[model samples]
Target: MTSLELQRTNLPEGLEELLGPKGLLTGEEAREYGRDFMGEVDNAPLAVLRPETTEQVAEALRLCTEHGLSVIPQGGRTGLTGAGVPSRPDHEVILCLARMNKVRWLDEKNHAMAVDAGCILADVQKAAADANRLFPLSYGAEGSCQIGGSISTNAGGTAVLRYGNTRDLILGLEVVLADGTVLDMMRALRKDNTGIDLKQLFIGSEGILGVVTGAVLKLYPAVAERECALLAFPSLPAVMKSFAIARESTNDRLSAFEMMPQNGITLACNRVPDVVDPVEGDYPWYALLEVSASKEGSGLFEMLEGLIERLMEEGLVVDGTVSSNEGQRAQLWRIREALVEAHNDMPHLLKHDVSVPISDMADFIETAIEKVQAIAPDAMLIAFGHVGDGNVHFNICHDLDTPDGSLATRHKEVTWAVYDLVQEYRGSFSAEHGVGSMKRDALRRYRSEAELAVMEKLKTALDPQGLLNPGKVI
Candidate 1:
């Protein structure tokens, strides 16, 4: 039988009745949620379940579990990896959290916000801002990505240098297990000496253990004074030195320290609209730095200006443009934001989100670029990312001069070549992007047998039938 016919034939008897017409979707409705952001995985799901309430999600999971049906927990479906999208859409049911979106409560006094898993991250940030607080988990997809997906991947964005990852920003989570058991630990507490902290397991678990239903997120004071600058560095070492000096001088006010290569900037300017390089002339490398202080009269702009001036004077910086206003700051940030879009304008790209120690970032990038060049001479290395937090989006793509070749043919070799170097540098193969189906094999190969065994045990203990997000991570 055909995939759709097989799915329709095997669907649980009470699924339709339990979900109602609007909640359960099939055919075109289900097909719409199939592909990811980049259309990398385009297989259609068996059905899509739009559960409005936590109880409905519980019921759906329970029914799917009873019928031995694997369900993929979906968020905004903006993930790069095929985590939210169904890889095996022939049989998998998509449990989308879009309908469950709600900002449950905002505690301004406590500097915490309780929100449903389905709430868009931008909305969450706005809610926090509405209360005169800051969410601090800023990313390119903030407007589209969901809270649950962000937490599931333990998203690390630009501000992770100061605020930490999504895992660190969250205090508690309300998760639904494979068998529909609700683990409600959503307490808005800064300190909890509770046993085990089961929430942490599900935070970065990528829905292997359980589906994140809701969360209580930490918040911070809103920035009263802010300064952003785009600086061109003479060398990688100079960028590193500038980072140290800025971090030390700013007194922990350094909110973001992003690194970008000239080639990537050129690509962005050529392909992406309104993407202008803030720093004039051609420079090998650049750094986008931001400093912010919540308190009024903090002299943050002066501090940033003085710091940049000192760096330029020291010969660490070749050229630079400091943001005079919020509009200018946004314009400065647009260069980094336009990178992925510019890359998509190309063909056959291999993106690797890897991380190493902060000190090793420059060396790792330098060595990896040379090694990748040796492997794929024609491939252009678009190296850039959050240098402050040691994460790099070391993406490789076909250059204009090279004849377009099959990316699939060279994918494995190029992957290993990059990953092997990442391993050598004591860096993680997968950084902000969690181990979805894309990096499952990498996890097995790199991780110790003992670690894999322990993970399997946890999987078995939590999801005995192996029904929740099967073929993802472990």
Candidate 2:
């Protein structure tokens, strides 16, 4: 072991006493926590702290504060942004919430479930399903992501069009401040109009304000019937027009309106195993839409059929495929879910999670494609995302024919051009993905001065010593 390992094992004062041998991890045992999902940034921390209970977390925080040790709160480490990982890892203690995974109780009357922050989202969804209810915070990382990280980042996924973001699914939160003080606001009430809702402060703060230890998440009635369809569009305008029509025609039952380009689907079909194309032939754009009803006999299938027929007649959709059973529906959804995993194999790729006004999405895509092609002529664009919510995962990959170092030289220019166009259209550069260290500069460039000032003031007020997740999210 190195001198750092010895020092970490021999922690300062009350820390070792509060957190036992299993709670504290050092050297190799703690090394993996320092790395994130994408291996682009690596920061080996001093130690990894695992506190099983809220009291344990509080004591750890209090001890760290007293000893002047920086604490970086981390969850499943599935975030695209570097929020869970630390910049100054040698001096930071990663507060991993792995041990706090537990469901405290299910309030059937209140239609909510109180869960520890470390609870896996998939487990929560399963629990809700067991109770004959639904937890609507669906995402690709549901199998691994913890509730705390989801709440911290305010994750947006396919279900955002219907159930809203993670913020909407949460009713209350129990957080621990930098000084180890516990702010318990775990109320399972929907109509709490008493002053400012304290839980909202830490919802999307990304652990900059404090660590979320527990949450009371809102639940909904489980869907009894649903329909899934994959439709091919001749152009981007047709996709946007179809989105508007879907929203207006579905009677508010449309759960997901995910868009994918031909290249994106091609990438998934070619790279990811067991992910076959749902439709025949190729089109410029496609949409994987779902309409679900809580009642069994809600006529959702009939409604979808009528919508598809009308779209065909209007020349909006050139080709389409609808799922007749659960197996087919899951297969259709897999194509969309595997897109990110497929693109993960690219040698050099640039990713941007941005959102534009629903009305300007088509124009933004057309103009961005032209501009990006001009910047990197050999680059292949793979743009797709939740077009219903106006969030697009505008991404590009270096063509195999391009010479090495060419993309590296033009990376910055291409990024700036894309963001500039997004800004020109009055869209957000960072949509669902929070501003972690990777996007800190972008946040500074795009965010308003007054808004940043308020965030800084709040940070100072909460973490006066600046020891909690330093250099993250304002």
Error of 2 at 186 (Å): 0.1
- Judged by lDDT against the true structure, how good is candidate 1? 0.88
Question: Judged by TM-score, which candidate is best?
Answer: 2
* Model 1 collision count: 0
Q: Mark the 10 consecutive residues where model 1 has the least summed lDDT.
A: 400-409
lDDT of 1 at 180: 87
Model 2 Cα lDDT, one tens digit per residue, 1-474: 877657575555777668888988878888888888888668988888999999999989998898888899999999888889888657788999989999999987779999999999999999998998999998999999999999999999989999999999998899999999999999999899999888999998889899999999999998899999999999999999999999999999999999999988988898889999968888999999999988999999899999999999999999989999999999999999888788876857899999999999999999999998887877888899998999999988875556664556698888889999999988998889888888888888888999999999999999999999888887
lDDT of 1 at 325: 85
Candidate 2: segments with Cα more than 4 A from true spot: 1-5, 401-406
